[model samples]
Target: MKRLLRAVPIAAAASLAMPAHAQFAKPEDAYKYRASVMFLQSQHMGRINGQLKSDKPDLALVAENAAILDVVNKLSFTAFPEGSDMLANSRAKPEVWSQAAKFKQYADRLNVDVGRLLAASKGGDLAATREAFQATAKVCKACHDDFRRD
Candidate 1:
């Protein structure tokens, strides 16, 4: 009876985990997930920006936020599936599908700039972090200008 109880719990856990792996089963799911990730990234970036503007910027907080941004930047590309552009709630432009290669290039550039920002934050140099942040923000702006709808 104990073994049966343990097995039941294990089976239930496995079933719960299965849905997590199949999270983006539809195009709208992917679009919604991408929107959530973008929202998270923006929130983290805003935190870092707020810190940078403060008189006593906290390097530790900056490093943590930058690390999150680094990971989020890598994850942002995976959400843009082929048909995701057609989703009603998606702010992504149709050019994302038509100009896939260009969009990917911009994504790569943003990833690189985010990496630099993370490195700068880790180095604990406020000036370097500011410069890196500006570079990263510019990459984001350029991509948004070209691919995202206002």
Candidate 2:
């Protein structure tokens, strides 16, 4: 009888601790994750833009180049899995969920562009890298135009 009572309260407490079907453990965690992704995006975009404007463009020379790639790789590998914090980001347009196919297309195109830029980065092939960077920028802009709000 005592064990049953203890178990009952434990179960009740556990149930109360978490909401049913809750995607994020905490709202702040969602915010943190979103901020992290935003930081990575800004860094990546800024480096490419600066590289484009430089007389001798080279992504490899950027301080955040390797770090950006590290985050980018992480972003690529971490599956949002529909209900992850990234999916809950307010900056993430509803179209990300509603039009997943098109979103994925943009994502794939961005991947190819990023890959090309990285591959061409080491040999001072700034022009070629800039072309890829420009394509990636277009992909970002296109998606934001269609999916994100100001």
Candidate 3:
């Protein structure tokens, strides 16, 4: 019957909409989240690079003045699910989800470094800000080198 047909499609869609994310039901979501965080972090860093590369004091001041901690501040405490199949084409190493503890440690270090950078920036100290920024990059790179596929 027509009623039965309608009910069947609705039921099928309902099943697909189920939100049973296995601690990590889709692996690619991890990659997506990582990409999101890194992209946001780099935006400001890119500005800093341009300012330093030009060696313009006024440029440096303008870059620092326009800077804010909010970008990195909003990125903490996020965790990716462990084994979602959505990660099929991702460059993230399975070890990242497999070794959650180490992954978390690296994330925490980034949070700390960003926090320090935020404070240093507020003081208008460009040198300290650059050091903290590099430290944050190191934390991210160190982990990626070991666990990322590419």
Candidate 4:
């Protein structure tokens, strides 16, 4: 039972990454995959922001949204495979591929930032959570400014 409980979390984490491992059939598919994942991320962030703006900020809800953000965040970066920027629906700039290392740096930083946000929310510290949220948003904005087309 103890071993099974431990494996459950491991299995769950692996499943979340399953899509990232799959080869997208085409550039459009890759764009769609990343776009969908990013959409989910945006929606979750909006939900957390809404909770934060409420008179009675619900740290629990924030944490829930943060958790979802944490997972979707990891997934989106993986979908930005080569040549996906050519897709009509893609807003990704050439910099995403041209300045690959810098783009990856942003992706890695965003993951860490979101992790911090999750920790702050789970700790039930509203101020800390707000600070962490802002930090995460800054990373997102910086990445968008550099890699995404307007």
Candidate 5:
């Protein structure tokens, strides 16, 4: 009885901690979650861009946004479950599911580029940060070109 009770709570906690992709009850929910995460990523990217364009860039602000982007980047890819791309507002292309390996490659590259951006920002190297930021943007553009619809 005691062991069963302990196992029950452990299972419940594990269920509660399920990945976002599995927690979605419907395609729409996944689409909404993906859209929200993308919006966050865009917003932070814009903030970092604005700072970069400034006469004197704020490395601290860029680092902060980069950190947020790292987390948001991870969330964005997980929300794109198989059926979510069928939604009316979804920009994801069929290739996202059909070419899953290629899509995953882009996702993995984005994570790596974003990590570099974060590291550069935190290191307070403006030149390196700019280069890393451009690389990150390139990955994003490449992924969108291949996987997103018009």
Candidate 6:
């Protein structure tokens, strides 16, 4: 009886801690989340770019930004469920779902490029960081061109 009571409260607390629509009750929610994450990724990328352009670039900030980009890059792909592409406000192209394998390949390339960027940033080599950033940008543009709408 004591164990059951303890488990009940723990279970309830765990359930309550989850987001209201943790499973995405509507496709719009997934689309919104995806948009938000992309915005965050862009912000981090912008920060890195700005730092690189500065007369005295801050390698620490660049590394921090790259780390953030690495994490966000991992998260972006999960937001695109089957129905998420159908959301009225979503800028995701239908090809993202129709050509899922290709989309995933692009996403994987992004992961690799971001990892390289993170590694270069950590090494504190400005030239290498610039090269890695260019590689990452190319992956982003390729994915966006194939999977996103204007």
Q: Candidate 4: lDDT over CA atoms?
A: 0.79
CA-lDDT, candidates in order: 0.76, 0.56, 0.55, 0.79, 0.79, 0.76
TM-score, per-candidate, Cα-based? 0.82, 0.65, 0.64, 0.85, 0.85, 0.83
Which lDDT value does model 2 have at 64?
44
Please provide, for model 4 over 1-150, each residue's C-alpha lDDT reduced to its tens digit, 9 standing for 90 to 100: 223223323333343354436355666777788888888988998998899899999999999999999888888876766666776778899887678768778877888889999999999999999999998889989999988889
Worst 10 residues of 1 by lDDT: 1-10
Q: Could you give the candidate ranking by lDDT, starting with the highest?
A: 5, 4, 6, 1, 2, 3
Alpha carbon lDDT of residue 101, candidate 1? 69
Given candidate 1, what's the lDDT at residue 108?
A: 79
lDDT of 6 by residue, 1-150 (tens): 222222223332232223332345566766787788899999999999999899988888999999998888766776665656665688899898678768878878888888888888898888999999998889989999988899
**Residue-pair clash count for candidate 6:** 0
Q: How close is candidate 5 to the true structure, as a TM-score?
A: 0.85
lDDT of 1 by residue, 38-108 (tens): 88889998999999999999988999999998887766776665656766778899898678768778877
Shift of residue 77 alpha carbon in model 1, Å: 0.5
Among these predictions, the greatest lDDT belongs to 5
What's the CA error at residue 35 for candidate 5, in Å? Answer: 0.6
Which residue pairs show collisions in model 2? Answer: none
Candidate 6: misplaced stretches above 4 Å?
1-22
